[model samples]
Target: MSSGKEPANGTSGTVRRRTSTRSVTLRDVAAHAGVSSQTVSRVLRIPDEVAPHTRARVEEAIRECGYVPNLAARNLASNRSKIVATVIPSLSASVFSETLTGLSDVLAPEGYQLLLGYTDYDDEREEALIRSLVGRRPDGIVMTGAVHRETIVAMLRTARIPVVETWDWTDTPLDVLVGFSNERAMYEMVCQLHGAGYRRPCFVGSLPAGDHRARRRLAGFRRAAAEHWPGREPRVVDASGHPLTLESGARLLDVARGAHPEADVLVFSTDIFANGALLAAARRGLRVPEDIAVTGFGDFELSRMLHPGLTTVALPNATIGREAATLLLRRMRGERPTTRTIDLGFEIRRRGSA
Candidate 1:
């Protein structure tokens, strides 16, 4: 079906249709840009190698034709996906989202994309995500915590890709660790509360069995309570199977207050809980740090804005993300980092709430 007549403007000396059912190809871009197919390929693979004016013309042609480079074919040729897979517990929480922001800030400049997955604090769901993400052969993987099922660990080992575990510290990490000690941070928080003469402090948190970090925090609270108040059992209200939220926090506050009327301070595992408790107290017309004092972890922005600004443990959430990404990048480049574990530590911020 060759047209004997030349095309309008006589650019290629062949008749060309403006529209076609077939997908646009490199040759099509080349023809439209008035360049050879090789030049178009070079522009795609290494734009810096091509002259500026030629590169601009090819780039313009690409945009006009709506050409999408075949990433699968390109990856196969280069043996790299240029993608990083990250799995975290919750998307609703600002803690994880802030970390993701830091991760993106570092990864984006290097031309890497993130494949995100959320587990909602479920180990089995995390294991499933690990399996699926590993199957895709990403350049690297970043997980929320150091704890993982043995099968998941073995699968990642077999895959032999760079892996980074963040948000919780561990001496024996699966590959690399970038986080602070949850136990140490909570321990310091409790110690600070005790030092401030807040006796009969009660810990309110989610079920420890579901989250290792929460378990560590509970252990820290217990350790500090035992040391500070001898022979007195540490009061605790376990919000079993409840999602960490303002409503749950408010409900837990009522339960803790009812059960432990003698307790002077209520230390929550996260700011969401503590903030909820504050709201409940406000609604009930109770004065904070007089009727009861409240403290929380993850010094959220809302914590600072509350009627009585919350006293909480401030973690280096974004720094953890940036450090994890940096370590992953180093490992991906075949560099063996001498230090596999990094502990950024935490700070306890004292505010009107406590």
Candidate 2:
């Protein structure tokens, strides 16, 4: 696992016990070199911070003990962290989960490991997490969303490491990027709905925060609605992210029934949200596509399993991860990847929902 520890082997004799921690610390290096911890720290932090001879001795001690510095200290010293820390919202969600799986699959061959963290959809938390991750100075930084804090953007600008934004794309990328256009894809899906004989469409999903990706999708939906309906616009039913269960789908249905009783179709940015919307529709005795059509993106597994299966746009999440990882490895190897934004294409899986 590269845990910075030596593997233990069983012995025959009764072993004398010592502290288990052994990968080398400043104290250990200092003791080995007959110096103080502060001196060793300075040397480890940077050779220029200490005398040349002392730095040489510390280096020797480090080599002898097979020591690896703490990630932060090492990063500050060498200006690069070998680990690629990926921060996402929740790992339990299929979209990010599948995307992460794709990232792992692609990076495995390139000797890069992913160090991941979660932010629970909080913008401030995400900003803080990205800041902390950046302090470590990773070789490459891969984030779930394209939008980031201004401070984070500034950090990426000077970090000299490739920051690859996945799950969505923008016109201006920090360095390298991959994945489909979230807003444009939603626009296309809306276009599909218009072509399917649906006039007024409503969006059923979480309330848009400053989440640029979600906002983009919403904007696209609005644009499509404006283009198709001319003057009449569709209503948006924004839901809470708390207690995300299938039952909550019913609430969205209630909203649809109450607010947009005249609307003919509902478009969900995510399949999970769409699933909930569909469930609510079935319970309301509304025959999908007959009474009110439902459409979704990220073609989840359940999209195909439901009765009168959901009509959705299939997003190649795994393909995105694979491509993102490939691009990252190429950048690491000084091989510049040609494309920044990869469409991966979208397919309309029309079963019965819309």
Candidate 3:
């Protein structure tokens, strides 16, 4: 029977009794498992701190009694909080969200909780968030975009937790990293555009801002243009990648149109900018791929659905997350994890737009 009432958890609806009569506590579980309170604490806080037999006994007791530890209280006793934190510059794009999905998928089965923080592209904010995450002393840390303040890098080096940096790659990594080649991806796109008969192309999007990945892509794009075209380097407008938004795309369209009237193609840093370019081009009465060809990164779903589907660089967002999380878990199990970086693959999406 369904009731419109709520339980003693405090609601105006009907209530149902819990399946178990007794509230499961750490002490109760310890007693049932024939272990001391201290042992149980050790088992929960740092399972590796206890012997295998003791851990098994504690876990068995937890399962049998349906015991749940108070996370807040448990965190205070040990340095390891058993929580994982992922700091993203922004979660607005489905790309980051998908990455987050992968992270959670891997962590959930291990009985560890994942926490999220958004720095909104502010370096100072990132520094602050890093401090907070460090204070919690989580078992693992996953960060988006490898660019970090020196203090944050030092902190991660000292925190001694399993750290996985994702979304972008550099020759050096803080620890384990799962990412795609942002610079090379852009380089490949630029070469493709040139071979496709784009003699005068202009790159659009925000400056790297505080984002090292976007900057690298920009650098690669410029390099390709300068190398292939020689004296005809593509025109570029640097928007701030820090507060990256679709609105920046509008500005990009105007800037490209005004500065490089001879441009036959425009390379945008992301789908958001690409979409804006599309709208701006339409409003300016320019035909896509005819008067002006547009290309974007991060082949989001909307890229295909739009008129004259956007040609873009597709990043394996979910795959990066899954791989990063998996790596962290392996490290947490005391396995010696090698390879600080994992470069997931990406591709160029050819569409009607370019």
* Colliding residue pairs in candidate 3: 5-13, 5-14, 6-13, 206-239, 207-239
Q: On residues 50-86, what C-alpha lDDT tens digit does candidate 3 reach at each position?
A: 8898899788777776777787775676545778998
**Which pairs clash in model 1?**
none
Q: How does each model score on lDDT?
A: 0.89, 0.76, 0.82
* Tens-place lDDT digits, model 1, residues 1-354: 986765543265342444667777787788878889899999988889999999998898888777888888999898999999999988888989999999999999887999999987788888899999999999999999888888899999999999999999899998989999999989999999988989889999986443888889998999999999989889998886567789988888899999999999999999999999999999989899899999999999899999799999999989988999999999999999889899899999999998
Worst 10 residues of 2 by lDDT: 9-18
C-alpha RMSD by candidate, in order: 2.9, 9.1, 7.4
How do all the candidates rank in terms of lDDT, highest first?
A: 1, 3, 2
Instruction: Give the 10-residue window scoring lowest on summed lDDT in candidate 1.
Output: 8-17
lDDT of 1 at 33: 83
TM-score per prediction, in order, is 0.93, 0.77, 0.80
lDDT of 1 at 291: 95
Which residue ranges in model 2 land beyond 4 Å of their true spot?
Answer: 1-80, 240-244
Candidate 3 root-mean-square deviation in Å: 7.4
TM-score of 1: 0.93
Winner on lDDT (2 vs 3): 3
TM-score of structure candidate 3: 0.80
